[model samples]
Target: MPYINVRLTRKDITTEQKAQIVREITATMQSVLGKRPESVHVVIDEIDPENWGYAGELTSVHRKRQG
Candidate 1:
């Protein structure tokens, strides 16, 4: 089984975009590693910006500064 974890801050990502991500990842595993699509597990972990940090600051802070 190929387990893939996709972590992203909850933002403006559409439902179709999320589904496409899962489909492509599973396809990659199936093609590259010969893992069956049914055996490929893709987990999308949506995180709150306040809880996701980068460069010693939270993502929410980064976005606020950008705005």
Candidate 2:
């Protein structure tokens, strides 16, 4: 069995995008780890902008810095 935990900041990403990500990740795990799709569990966590940070800045601020 494969268990995946995905954490991301809440932004403008769509549900379809998230689903696609999950599918692709699961497929990759299935091929590499030889795990079945049904045995894989994917957990996506949408974090708050204030909670997720990088480079001593919150996600909202970090994104602007990158851009």
The candidate that achieves the highest TM-score relative to the unseen native structure: 1
How do the predictions measure up, each by TM-score? 0.94, 0.81
Q: Which stretches of candidate 1 lie over 4 Å from their true place?
A: none
31 Cα displacement, candidate 2 (Å): 1.0
Tens-digit per-residue lDDT, 17-66, candidate 2: 99999999999998998988999888899998889878788887777767
Off by over 4 Å in 2: 63-67
lDDT of each: 0.93, 0.87
Prediction RMSDs, each to the true structure: 0.7, 2.0
Worst 10 residues of 2 by lDDT: 57-66
CA lDDT, candidate 1, residue 67: 100
Measured on C-alpha atoms, candidate 2 has an lDDT of 0.87
